[model samples]
Each structure stands twice: as structure tokens, then as C-alpha cells.
Target chain A: MTEFLQQLLNGLSLGAIYALIALGYTMVYGVLRFINFAHSDVFMVGAFIGYYLGHHVPESTVWGGLLVLTAAMIGCALLGMLIERLVYRPLRSAPTLNVLITAIGVSLLLEYTGQLVFGAAPRTFPPIFPSANFHLGPLTISSNQLLVISVTLILLFALRFIVMRTKIGTAMRAVSLNPRAASLVGINNDFVISFTFALGSAMAAAGGILYALNYPSIDPLMGVMPGLKAFVAAILGGIGNIPGAALGGLLLGTVETFVGGSEWSTYKDAIAFAILIVILLFRPAGLLGKFTVEKV
Target chain B: MDWPLTQMLTVKNLEVCYGAISALGDVSFSIAAGRIVTLIGANGAGKTTALRTISGLLRAKSGHINFNGEDLTRLPPHQIVARGICHVPEGRMIFSNLSVDENLAMGAYLQRDKARIAQNRDYVFSIFPRLKERLTQAAGTLSGGEQQMLAIGRALMGDPKLLMLDEPSLGIAPKLISTIFEKIVEINRNHGLTILLVEQNARLALEISHEAYVLETGRVVLHGPSPELRTNPELKAAYLGG
Candidate 1:
């Protein structure tokens, strides 16, 4: 039972990272109705930013860690907005396939670009927070795990507040419902789309930084696998639903962690794809997603 | 009433096209301040297209739309809204995911003064008490009539100088149609709002309108006062269904 509890904590901690990354997928999909495949590359850039920032700061305190995280989030937010403007803006009226292909192309561009800039060789992520292990009732929790969970909670709450309580957030939802109607009420949809990208990318940055803190490895291709899993998580939660994405991420993390600790450890990545398939078959709209008839 | 009153809005030789198919061609009309002007036509007669063009949703291929003495031919939809032109679009396009209050809040998207926004909210609630009762409900869950009311209410939240309502009577229950029409009259009378109402329900639209224009296949086939158009034998046979 204690072992099960231990695995649960590990799973939740892992899920927190996935949840942060999945939010970008779900939100961008909500507004644009297309999966931004390059989002994972944004995650990669975030980790790289954190690595460099941590190296320069060299003070592994919690406050220092938060400063690095904030910096990474801001950087990724601008990067995300830039990507939306330079790449997706021109293709706003184009067919969905063109955009999807462009996204994959952007992903490759980021990866190759990162490889050229930072080199293809893997670099160890410097510690951004001092490590500590706390044992409570036979369950041991690492400082990184606690940090990941707490930060995830803070972000999720902030996200909920923004999406539900703020005026711009209301405009965002209105745009997602009907862009023409949104513009009729004086919403600059281009600005809203850019803002959505910035918000989503910021969360992914936090995910990237937290993931590095726990795993301590960084590379150009590092985001590929985690990105795929997070996409799967978004789908599992219902692709366009914010809360659904978070729930799906947690569930996916738990299942993957349990599996990884067992003899079928090699099937960890495969498990995500498997769950995605099963979920698609059973509930194509996802666990929390309602099946909506396409409005003509 | 003067035949040619002071014009609040004017469209001159406006033409809109979807590639090769012209949706609106050489459409010219004008609305006086505080007058309810309506465009009555068949479904593909481009009535909605004219309203869409006026509200800046569709760009005019060649022509001019002047509103409140300013040219609005090339402005974006949001900019047009800023110029006090609010369109309560066809199909009652309310945000389904948002609450009734949130939908109204979105209607007042550009309004910065909180106090005035509250007054607008109060006005909306007074006009549609049912909306106030269901302030927390998602707009999609509203019945067709309620949705129509909410759409108008949302538009009113903008405090528009010129309100363009597209098919407000479409898909509404017969019992609620009269009530909605009454609300339309009350909105015009009390608020003194200039209206450009587009409708497929010619009889109801003509009955409530001060001036009426008949559109057929992207052209204005007839233009006259509502009572004159209402009594026309040819219009009665064709549109009013003799």
C-alpha cells in the first residue's frame, strides 16, 4: 500500500508537467481548431532557456528557481506569439492541412535550429533549486516533486481565474465559439489568437523548466516524446477543454508511472498511444468533451 | 413624415462578391436616425449579405458605406463596432459555453466605464427579464426564442447608435414572435435607436418598419414606405403570399 502511495506521488508529480504542456495544445486547438505540432519545440526552447539562466544565476534557491521559471515563461510567451504571427497568421484562411504541415515544418525548424545553435550534443541542466527529500509516513517526496506539484497548482488556478473571471478571457471563449460573432462585438481576433499562443506557451515553459529540474537533461529533440505524450493527454482529456486536458494529463502520468516501475518499463511511451487509441474508440470527443454537431 | 429625412446611414453602389457570384450588387439605400428600416427578401436575395456588408463582415467589391457622416466602407468589423454599428447576427450566434451574464459582458466589450456597463446591464435585464432570471445559465441551453432575445440583448449591451438585426424572427416559436416584435418596437421607440432589420418574414417586417426595401437576387427591386409596400398588389401576390 505504501509502495502504491509512493508511485501515486511520483505519477502526480510527472502528471503536473504533462498537464502544463497539454494546456497549450488544448487552448490553441480551442481557438484555431488545429494542433500546433511545434508546441513541443516551444517546450524544448524553454528547457534550454532555463539551462542557460540557471548556469548564469548559480544560486539554487527556491526564489532563484522561481525567477528562472518566470524568465523562461516570459521568453516562451514571446516566442509563441512570434511563431503565431510569423508562421500561422498568413495561413489564417488557408486549409487546415496546410497549417498542420506548416506546424510540423516549424517543429523541425526549431529542432534543427536548436541543434545548430546549442549543438546536437545533450547538455546536463544545472540545478535551479536546492534538492531535499522529505519522508512522511513511509512515503518519501523529493523537493523537485513538491515544487512541480505546487507550481502546477498555482498555474492551474491562475489559468482558471484568467479563463473564467477576466474580460479578455471571456473574449477568448467568445472567439472560440464564433469568430465572426466575436469580431461583431469588437474583439481583435488576431490579438486574441496571439494572446492564446502566449498563454499556452508560457505554461509549456513552466512544464519544461519543471521537467528539467526533475530529470536534469536537455537536448534539441528532448521535447519530441514528452510533446507527443502531452498531445495524447490533451486528446484524452478532450482536446479543446481546459479542465479536461489537466485531468487527462494526471491520468496519463499515473498510468505511465505505474507501468514504468514494472517489468513492462520499455512500453511506457507505447502505453500513452494505446490509451489514446482506446479513448478515441470509446469516446472520440474525449472523457469530458461533448460531441458537438458542426454548425453550418 | 418627410419623404427624404436627414440620413443617418447611406450605401452607394455597394457590390459584394463571393468569387464570381455577386452577393450584393449596386445596393444603394439610406436610413434616417430613429427610423426602423427593413430589407425584406427571399433567402438567396442577399438581404443578409447586405447587412453583413454594412457591418463590415464582408468587404464591398466596389462602392461606399457611409455611417453617421463617416465612411465605413473599408473598416474592419471591430472598428465598425467602435463606430457604434452593432450586428445581432443570423442564427442567434450566442457563445454557448459562456453564461448569459458573460455573453452580455462580451456585448459591452469595448465599454470601459464600469458604472455605465452596469446601467446597460440593468437596461438589458429590464427589457428581457427572462435573461436576468437565467443570468448564470449557458446561452446554448436557451430555447430558440430566449436565444433570439439574448442576441438582441447582447447587441443592446453595446449601446449601439445603429443596430442591425438579421432575421430576429427566424426559427422562433409562433407564440413568442409577437412578443419579440413588440420588443423590437419598444427598443426603437424608447431607445431612439436607428435600425436596419433584415428579415425573410416580409409581413411582420413590413408591418413594424417605417421604410422597407425589397431585394431580389442582389438588386433593390422596390423601395417605398412600409404602408405603401404593404398594400401593393404585386408585392402581396409575390412576397406576402396571396
Candidate 2:
């Protein structure tokens, strides 16, 4: 039971990071109806930003950690908006296939550019939070695990409030539903799309910070595997459904962690893809996505 | 092009095309302030296209759309809406995922004045009491008639000077059709709003409109005061039942 509980705690912490990255994929898909392949690079950039801040700040307090997280989020949010304006905005009215190709191109551009600038060497992540572990009845939990879970919960609640209770969030939902109709009622859809990118990228940045804390290694290519896994999580939850993305992330994290701990750990990555294929075969719209017939 | 002083909206020699196929050609019309003008035609007669062009959804290939003294043909849809032209589109394009209240809030998105937005909300509620009852409900779950009402109510939240409705009567129950039309009249009368109405139901459209235009294959075939068009033998045979 203790071993089981230990695995559960670890899985939940990993899942929290996956949920944050998944949110970016799901939100971009929600409003734009296309996968932003460059989003994972944004996650990597967030980690780098957090690393730089950690080296400069020289404090291991909760407040210092929060300050680093905020800086990274803001930096990533700006980067996301810049990407949308430069690459995506021009192709907003283009065909879906054209946009999809452009997204893949953007992904490559970011990856290569990151390689040139950040170098190919993986750097150790600076510890921004105090090192502590708490033992509860035969199971031990690290402070980093508690931090990941708590930050994820707080960010999710903040996200909920922004999406459900705010005006811009309401406009975002409207634009997602019917952009032309939204425009007729005075909503600037381009502006809303830009905002969506900013918000989603910020979440990804928080994920990056939490990920660096847990993994202790950061590199230009760090975003690749996590990005793919989070994408799978988004698809598992329902691509455009926010809550579904969160649920899917947690579930995927738990499953992956369990598989990695077993003798067949070499097949951990294979399991996610296998589950994805099975889900697609049975429920193409995803666990929470409602299948809609296009009205002619 | 110089529009008449009384005209709230004027389309002069407007042309719109979808690639090579012409959707509208030299479609010209004018709406007087506070008057309900109806565009009646068969399917593909370009009634919806004309409205879409005026609201800046479709860019005009060549023409001038003069709305409230500004040239609207060149502006984007959101700018057109910001200039007090609100379109209640066909198929009742209410944001189904959003709650009725949120849908209404989106209508007044550009309006920063809290008090006026609140007042406009009250006005919309008064016009469609059913909308107020389901304010918190997702718009998609509402009945078709209720969705139509929410669409109109949502438009009204923008506090438009010229309200353009595209096929508001299509697919509605006969009982609610009259009620909807009556409410359209009431909105025009009470709000003193200039209305540009497009409808497939020619007889009913002519019955309530101050002026009417009949469109055929992207051209204005016939136009006059509603009562005059109502009595025209050719129009009566083609549009109203023989």
C-alpha cells in the first residue's frame, strides 16, 4: 500500500505538469482549430527563462520561486503572441492544410533556432525551491511534489475564473463557437486569438518551471517528448475541452509512471501511443468532446 | 456617392463575388432612418449576400456602402459593428457553447459603459422575457424559437443604430413567427431603430415592412412601398401565392 501510495504521489506531480502543457495545445486548438506545433518550444523557452531567473535571484524561498515562475510565464506569453502575429496571423484565412504545414514549419524553425542559441548541451536546472521531504504514515512526499500539485491547482483555479467569469474569456468562447457571428457583435477575433495564445503559453511556462524543478535537467530539446505526451493527453481528454485536457493529463501521467516502474518500462512510451490509437478507433471525438455535424 | 439625408444606410452599385461567380451585381438600395425595409427573394437571390456585404463579412469587389455618413464598404466586420451596425445572422448563429447571459455580454463587447450596458441588458430582457428566464442556460440547449429570440436579443445588446436581420422567420413555428415579427416591429417602433430585414416569406415581410425590394439572381428586380408591391400582379403571382 505504501509503495502504491508513493507511485500515486509521483504520478500526480508529473501529471500536474502534463496538464499545464496540455492546456496550451487544447486552447490553441479550441480557437484556431489547428495544432500549434511550436508550443512545445515555448515550454522549453519557459524553462530557460526560469533557469536564468533562478541563477540571478539567489534565494530559495517560496516567494523567489513564485517570482521566477511569474517572469517565465510573462516571457513565454510574449513569445507566444509574437509567434501568432508573425506566422499564424497571415494564414488565419488560409486553407487548413496550408496552416497545418506552416505550423510544422514553425516547429522546426523554433527547434533549430533553439539549438543554435541555447546549444545542444543539457544544463542542470538550478534549484529554486527549498529541499524538504515530509513522511506521512509510511509514504514520503517531497516538497517539490507538493509545490507542483499546489501550483497546478492554483493555476487551474485561476484559469477557471478567467475562462468562466471574465469578459475576454467569454469573448474567447464566442469566437471559438462562431467567429463571424462574434465579429458581427463587435468582438475582434484576431485579438481574441492572440489573447488565447498568450494565456495558453503562460500555462505552458508554469509547466516548464515545475518540470525543471522535478527533472533537474533542461535543454533545447526538452520540450519534445513532454509536448508529444501532453498532446496525447489533450487528445485523450477532448482536444478543445479544458477539463478533459486536465483529466487526460493526470490519467496519462499515472499510467506512464506505473509502466516505467514495472519490468516492461522500456515500453512506457509505446503505451501512450497504443492508448491513443485505441481511443481514436473507438472515440474519435475524445472522452469529453461532443461530435457535431456541420450544418450546411 | 451622396446618399440622401434621410437614408440611414445606402448601397450604391455594390458588387460581390465568390471567385468567378458573381454573388451580387449592382445591388443598390437605401433605408430611411427608423423604417423597416425588407428584402424578399427566393433562395440564392443574394439577399443574405447583400446583408453580409453591408456588415463587412464579405468584401465588396467594387462599391460604396454608406452607413451613418461613413464609408463602410472598406471596413472589416468588427469595425462595421462598432459603428452601430448589428447583424442578426441567418441560422441563428448564437454562440451555443456560451450561456445566454454570456452571449448577450459578447454583443456589448465594445461598450465600456457599464450603466448603459446594464440598461441595454434590461431592454433586451423586456423584449424577450424568455431569454431572461434562460440567461444562465447554454444557448444551444434552447428551443429553435428561443434561439432566434436570443440571437435578436444578443444583437440588441450592442445598441445598434441600424439592425439588420437575415431570415428571422425561417423555420419558426407559425404562432411564434407572428410573435417574432410583432416583436421586430415593436423593436423598430420602441427603439426607433432602422431595420433592414431579409426574409423568404414574401407575403409576411411585405405586410410588416414600410418598403420592400425583390431580388432575383443578384439583381434588384422590383422595389416600392410594401403596399404597392403587395398589390403588384407579377410580384403577387411569383412571390405571394397566385
Candidate 3:
């Protein structure tokens, strides 16, 4: 029972990271109805931003850690907005297939460009926050795990307040519901779309910094595996549903962690894909997604 | 016939196309301030297209749209809306996922003045008390008539100088249609708001409007005072089901 509790705690902390990244996918999907394939690369960029900024800030302090996270988030937010303006905006009225192909291209571009600039060798991520281990009965919980979970909770609440209570957030929802109608009501759809990109990218950046705090190893391609898992999480939660993404991330992370702790640890990665197939077959619209018939 | 009112909107030689298919061909019309003008036509006759182009949802391929002495031919939809022209589109495109209150708040998206927005909210509630009653309800759950009322009420919250309504009578219960039309008249008369109404119900459109334009296959076939167009034998046969 103690071991089970330990694994569950670890699973939830990892799940918190996935939830942060999944939010970006879900939010972009909500407003633009397309998967931003380059989002994972943006995550990698966030880690590198932190790596560079880590050199300047005092390590092992709360304020220093937050500063790195904020800088990474802001950098990635601007990058996300730039991507939308330069690439996606031109393809706004084009076919979905064209956009999908373009997204894959952008992802590859970011990956190879990252390799060129940052080098393909992996580097150790500097400790940004103070670390400690706590023993509760027979369970051991690391301070980094606690930080990940607490930060995710706070960010989630902030996101909820922005989306549910703020004017721009309401406009975002309106644009998602009906773009033409939103425009008729004096909403600049372009500005709203750009804002969605910035918001999602910022969350992904936060996820990147949090993930590095636990793993300590960073590389240009580090985001690919976690990015894929978070994409699955977003799909599991229903791509355009906000709370659904968080639920899906937690559920996926818990399941994957349990599988890793078992005898079939070698097959842990396969488990996520298998679950995706099962979900696609049984509930293609996702766990919380509403099935909607296209209007003619 | 038009002695007092100033020209509020003018469209000259406006042509709009979808790919190669022309939706509006040489459509020209003018609306006077503080008066209701109706464009009555068949489904394919470009009435909705005219309203859409005027509100800058669709760009005109050639020609000009001048609103209150300023050119609005190339402006985007949001900018046109900011310039005090609000469009209540067909099918009553309310954001169904949002509450009735949120929908009304969205209509005031461009307004910065708190007191003015509050006043507009009150005015909307007074015009459609049913909307006020369902303020927190999801807009999609409202009845067809109630949804139409919300659409009009939402547009009114924008504090528009010219209100363009497309098919306010469509898909609504017969009993509630008259009530909605009465509210439209009441809004125009009480507020002196200029209106450009497009409707498939020619009889009802003619009854409520002061001036009427008859459209057929993307061209204006006739234009006259509402009473004169109401009595025209050709218009009656084509549109009034005579």
C-alpha cells in the first residue's frame, strides 16, 4: 500500500507536467482547429532559454527558479506569436491538409535548426530550485515533485480565471464558437488567434522548465517523447476541452507510471500508444469531447 | 418623399463574387438616417450578400461602399463594426456555448465606456425581457424565437448607428414573429436608429419599412416607397405570393 501511494504521487507529479504541455495543444486546437506540430520544439527552446539564463541567475533559490521560468515562458510566447504571424496566418484560408503538412515541416525545421545552434550533445540542466526529500511514513517525496505539482495547480487556477472571467478570454471562446459571428460583434479574430498562440506557448515553456527540474538532462530533441505523450493526453481529454486536457494528462501519467513500476517496464512507452489506439476505437471524440455532426 | 433625412450609407456599383460566381452585380442603394429600409428578395438574390459586404465581412470585387461620407470599401469586419454598423446575421448566429449575458457582453466588445455599456445592457433587457430572464442560460438552449430576440438584443448592445438585420422572421413561430417585428419598429422609432432590413417575407418587410428595394438574381429589379412597392402588380406576383 505504501509503495502504491509512492508511485501514485510520482505519477501525479509527472502528470502535472503533461497537463501543462497538453493545455497548449488543446488551446491552439480550440481557437485554430489545427495541431501545432512545432509546439514540442518550442518546449525544447524553452529549456535552452532556461539553460542560458540559468548561468546569470543565482541557483537553488525560489526567485531565481521563477525568473528562469518566466523568461523561458516570455521567450517562447514571442516565438509562438512570430510563428503564427509568419507561417500560419498566410495559410489561414488554405486547406487543412496544407496546414498539417506545413506544421510537420516547421517541426522538422525547428528540430534541425536547434541541433545546428545548440549542438546535438546533451547537457546537464542547472539546478534552479532548492532541493530536499521528505519521508512520510514509508513514502519518500522529493521537493522538486512537490514544486511541479504546486506550480501546475497554481497555473491551472490562473488559466481558469483568465479563460472564464476575463474579457479577452471570453473573446477567445467566442471566436472558437463562431469566427464569422465573432467578427460581426467587433472582435479582431486575427488578434485573438495570435493571443491563443502566445498563451499556449507560454504554458508549454513552463512545462519544459518543470520537466528539466526533475530529469536534469537536456537536449535539442528532448521534447519529442514528452511532447508526443502530451499530445496523446490532449487527445484523450478531448482536444478542444481545457479541463479535459488536464484530466487526460493525469490519467495517462498515472497509468504510465504504474506500468513502468511493473515487470513490463520495457513496454511502458508502448502502453501510451496502445491506449491511444483503444481510445480512438472506443471513443474517437475523446473522453469529454462532444460528438458534433458537421453542418451543411 | 425624402425631404428631411440625411443619407447614412451609400453603395454604388458594388459587385461581390464567390470564385467565379457573382453574388451581387451592380447593386446600388442608399439608406437615410433614422429610417427603416428593406431589401426583399428570393434566396439567391444577394440580399444577405449585400448586408455582409456592407458590414465588411466580404470584400467587394469592384465598386465603393461609403458610410456617412467615409469610404468603407476595404475595411475589415471588426473595423466596420467599430464604425457603428452592427450586423445581426442570418440563422441568428449567437455564440451558443456562451450564456445569454455573455452574448450581450460580446456585442459591446468595442465599447470602452462602462456607463454606456451598462445603459445599453439595460436597453437590451427592456427590449427583450425574455433575454433578461434567461441571462445565465446557455444561448443555444433558448427557443427559436427567443434566440432571434437575443440576436437582435445582442446587436443593439453594440450601440450601432446603422443596424443591419438579415431574415429576423425566418424559422420563428408565427405568433412570436409579430412581437419581434414590433420590437424592431419600437427600437428604430424610439432610438432613431437607422436600419437596413433584409427579409424573404416580402409582405412583412414592406409593412415595417419606410423604403423598399426589390432584388432578383443579384440585381435590383425595383425600388420605391414601401407603400408604392406593396401595390406594384409585378412585385406582388413575384414575391408577395399573389
Write candidate 2's Cα lDDT for B71-135 as tens digits. Answer: 99899899998899999999989999888999999989999899999999999988899998998
Instruction: Give per-residue lDDT, candidate 2, residue B1.
Output: 52
What DockQ values do the models have? Answer: 0.88, 0.92, 0.91
Off by over 4 Å in 2: none
Interface Cα RMSD for all candidates?
0.6, 0.6, 0.4
lDDT of 1 by residue, A64-154 (tens): 8888999999999999999999999999999999999999999999999999999999999988898999999899999999999999999
Q: How large is the C-alpha RMSD of every model relative to the true structure? A: 2.0, 1.2, 1.9
Off by over 4 Å in 1: B1-5
Clashing pairs in 2: none
Worst 10 residues of 3 chain A by lDDT: A287-296
Question: Model 3, residue A10: what's the lDDT?
Answer: 91
Candidate 2 lDDT score at position B213: 92
lDDT of 3 by residue, A221-290 (tens): 9999889999999999898999989988888898899899999989997986797779878999888988
Best by lDDT: 1
Candidate 1 lDDT (Cα, whole model)? Answer: 0.93
TM-score attained by model 2: 0.98
